[model samples]
Target chain A: MNFILHISKLDKYFDNLHALNDVNFDAKDGRILGLIGQNGAGKSTTFHSILDFIKYNGEITWNGNPINEKTFDEIGYLPEERSLMEKATVQQQIVYFAKLKNRKANWTKPRIKNWMKKFDVKGDLNSKLKSLSKGNQQKIQLICTLIHEPKLIILDEPFSGLDPVNADLLKQSILEAKANGATIIFSSHNMNNVEEICDDLVMLRNGEVVLNGSVQAVRNQFGKNELYVTTPMPKEELRQLPGVETVFVRDNEKYKLKLSNPDAGVELFKLISKGEYIEEFSQQPPSLDEIFREKVGETNE
Target chain B: MVKLMNKFKAIVQETYVNQVKSKSFIILCLLPIIAIALIVIVGLISYQNAASSGNDDTNQIALIADSGIKKSIVQKDGDSIDSSIKTEQQAKHKLKNDDIYGYVKVTKNNDKYTAKYIGNESIDGGVRDDLMQNLSLHQNKLNLSNNNLTSEQIKKLSNKPSFYNYVKSRSNDNKSDDNDIKMGSLQLLIYILYFFLFFYSSITATVISKEKGSKLVEVIFSSTTATKYFIGKITGIVLMMLTQFAIYLIMLFSSYAFLSQADFAKSFIKENSNYVHQIVSNLFNINLLFIIFGLLLGIILSATAGSLVSRREDANKAGQPVFMIVIILFVLSIMFQNNSNSIIPKILSYFPLSSYFFMPIRMINNQANIYEGLISLFILIIFIIGLTYFISKVYKGLMLQNNNEGWFKNLIRGVKYR
Candidate 1:
């Protein structure tokens, strides 16, 4: 139940602009923390603060100790930009990174092959990094990031350029790493993917944490007023009913409706059931995407 | 502490291996060796060719005259009696037919004399000296005759003032020769050091900036301090420069040894033995510690400046200060080539930037003693350490700045802000 990582009262400024303002968050030892924000929302800046790459007013600790060079010994960081030497071959690049982490060549050479195989990346070990396609290069970068089996992995926009299949593969790898007890932290604009793998997330708006909790808890806090209805009636009829906010006809002649209140659910059900034969009415908590939009929308207003 | 050392060593090793294996570095290192070897080979071939040609002593030329002074000219000019008189057409025909190397045609026009010399080969220095002497004697006789004086008076006038020039001591001449050799060697060392400082430091800057642009600096900084990264990078480039210098030395020594075994090369080298002896003696006799320490400090200083760059495109901006120092050093080396004894050169030799050029010159001129050189080196070492420490302090924050500002501004800000 103890926090593996914690940052409280984190603040950063670049000139006159405030970048991160008293942002507070934490992650458990074996869970994934999704950092969700738009461009310039301070996700990358938060990561930078934690890694000590920039000067900031903050307190960041891992296992009750202030972060330092030793913190990186057990941590892996994949920068938003590709951090690789293009002219160097795959073997040279991997060995260079591994050696920087104090991994011996004898141990790293075999691990490189094993990781490349697991990632299903097909290329010669001696091939230069620039010769590989973007996806393959990303896979190699990922291997370098994860090969050390670090206790904490911080991936900044890890899925930026990944295709769907590669992203799925990466998701699986991340899950496996989590199962192996590594605390994973990542920042992404893709809400669906974030919801898929993240147990807890912090949503930042204008350098401030507006929503911070487990995905399920945060969604449940937003409350459940959405219902999927399979009916013969037109979707407009549901919108005209009292207590209904909006309705959309989904696939297979089903109408997914958003109600103004959970109490309105009975009214909409009664309205829909009175007119046409209703197949089923199921209510569910709001999606993380809806919660993110709702929280970010308030700040925008 | 052990982990830091290990990371530094790994970074140095990686930089060394990557640069050493690169085609550009390999080619850059090899070019100077190849060029020097080609120069030596070309010099040998041309020397042999010049030796095979007949000596200038054997060539013959004719002197034609239409003046009353012709016989007197020939008698006054020693070694000129071998020439046979001929008309202008005959001389030209002989020259064309290879019967004569060249001919000098003398004719009287108006009241003065005009001489025209043409030949297939350039007139030799000894021949030209004798001809000028004979012509001066003839002009003196003509002047005496026009003054209504007799030949006896002219002869007495020419023979009266016989003066001899002599060196009071050979040791002074040898010392001067040794100084020339030392200065020459020092100038050469200055050029080589300038090349190393300017080229290698710029390379280091480019590498740093390129890594910065790609976010590799973030990855490296995570595991090690900025000081370690700076030291490792500079050390890596220093090792590269040393490797290249070592290879060039090997090539030079091996070539010299190989050439010394051949009779032609040996004889050719012997003809310029005085120069060769001076160079070899200066190489062994000069204080090498000054040169080594000076170069090391200069390169480190340049590398420290280079680390301030944030992007590869602005590498020139980052490296400009070092390049300017090198250019100033080169210009001073040239300006003070013959004036190594001056106070200005000696004073400049104590500075860290110009010392790489000036210290060696002073050492070669025998003006800088061991203690003086060592003191200068000590000051330079201290300066290098201070600059490195200062730059390391700023390097971490400087590298993290995306550098939307100009490189110079970023550099200043990084240093000031830190």
Candidate 2:
């Protein structure tokens, strides 16, 4: 797939402190690119630079031409800070945002209405934004960002403060954007959603890209032959098996084992049979959360 | 340019509509009416008390003296004089019965004259002073009559070379009095105007800046040029102010119409009836026009400054200098009018802030001609608009800039920093 955006040797600094150092990245149309990092690891800084939040050295080109700010007329940005004018009404605010994206009011209003309805936000067009709950306000902001049908959307922790149902609702909306031929840049601390949606991703540490690629490929690239078993057995009994490097008990019913080779699973099967009949055995890929901890050594896990 | 202008018009229309519909805008408009009504009600009560205080203006005072003495002390606008009275007891009884406010009991005591006066608690200061002066004059006349002074001599004594002053210069006696009143009124008007402007613009500026502080500006900038958005935002706010002003004007007009028939109604204006006709001739004065224009300029310029900051708190801080400058100019304008034709007022009349308050007053009294006021007004307006444009440019640049930059440092960098 042809890359929609390419950034190379991109650098930024704040006085004596180097903020973004020689970052290299790529993204394609119709894809969701996840960005993961610690609180201070420059994920926000990168998104900001793309949106011209800061002036930086080096180049970030869109479709081979340098990304000019004027091109933002076709882009939507949802900042993680979660901001909106409380004084304005829901429809007035939505229309204003849509206007910024070059949409006419007559055309924009109905679309915002449809989005609000789809999200199950029941309210009149005249309801003040301040009266809405935190979750509902967030939904309004999301609707604002998504109103313009932008080609490129940057959502910085858009899932924050959302309940699981709302989060799922937002995820589906994002998938809908992808289906509509839009490129989405998603930055977050939550790995599960990143695993769920991101076709490719990068983990940054100390303003430098540490790991990058498709989540599955990257996990396998940093492979440790690991097996997670769910069996009705005690952890002490599983720990005594040969070829099992160690057994980490999740609870009474399930256990995770690190293996030296693919054949090490046979030893787990024998242990399972001796103690309690094995409920199930399957070689599952390491969760993205686990892989991130091992690579970045982040303590979030 | 036309495209941009059209966009600006659209923004302005939206702003005006929204602002007029806003609760705050409605309140701002209603405040002036409420204030006027309250003032009128309070004024009516005070005027009633004052009008009834001295309703008995016909009470007579007696002077026990000669027939010619009555002729010398006869008041032109008062009741027929009481020619003579016997004693002080009669005077006290007359005062108590409201037959007389007071009376002077004159008695010849050797060479020098001695007099005793009786009055009630309700006696006025002007009447008492007049009575005392008349008694002294009567004593002088009696002394002259005893010396067998001729009528020609008395006439000569009365004419003490009264000076009738005249001047062809811009400064003249009558003009000077007019200048003081004009200056004071002009200064107060400009101050009120500036206060209203600041109140309106600062709130809008705060709202705009909050968008940046809250990251709303950044999100909007993602889909449009910051310059366009900033221009649109300011345009919207100004339109709102205009709407508020229009509503306020309508309310004032209606209130005036309603009050003009009342007994205590002092017209719809805080000015003399002749002011409307008199102000016409002064309208052409360049200096006067300049001063008014300058004041308007100050409002616009200060508003532009107010909008340049990225936070509501920052706008308050940034707006202080502009506000102080407006107030200073307003004072200077008043000074210019009060000290008409003086070196200080003359010089300040050409100054940006000082001129708006001074010109109208000077022009009305014919202290300064129409052309001078108008020319000054035009220049001041241009200066203020230019300054506002520059400030707007700075605001546009900083709207998308890293808000972490401190206000003073960012200002020093001049809207662009690598």
Q: Comparing chain B with the reference, what is the TM-score for each candidate?
A: 0.71, 0.64
Residues B37-138, candidate 1, lDDT per residue (tens digit)? 786788778887787764443366777874554565566553632356457788788778776677777765654566778889866566666666666666
Which lDDT tens digits does candidate 2 get at residues A27-97? 78899999998787898889978876668987887778766555776688998889877678999888877
Residue ranges of candidate 1 with Cα displaced over 4 Å = A1-3, A248-254, A274-280, B55-179, B271-298, B301-306, B315-318, B336-347, B416-418
Interface RMSD of each: 1.5, 3.2
Candidate 2 Cα errors over 4 Å, as ranges: A1-3, A63-70, A231-246, A261-277, A298-301, B1-35, B42-58, B62-92, B103-176, B193-201, B241-271, B274-318, B321-397, B400-406, B410-418
TM-score of each: 0.83, 0.77
lDDT of 2 at A122: 57
List, for all models, the DockQ compared with the true complex.
0.53, 0.39
When candidate 2 is compared with the true two-chain complex, its DockQ is 0.39
In candidate 2, what are the lDDT values of residues B1-418, reduced to their tens digit?
A: 4433443454555556766777777777778878987979887888788778655533567665544544555553145335445566776676677776677666667545666666664444565566567667777877787788789988876786779887754333466555555554555455555576467545655555566667776776676555565566666666565566568658866766666666676553434434433342333345333433543564455444544565655755656656666666655655554467777777666676666655555564467776787676776777776765766656545655545455555555436633
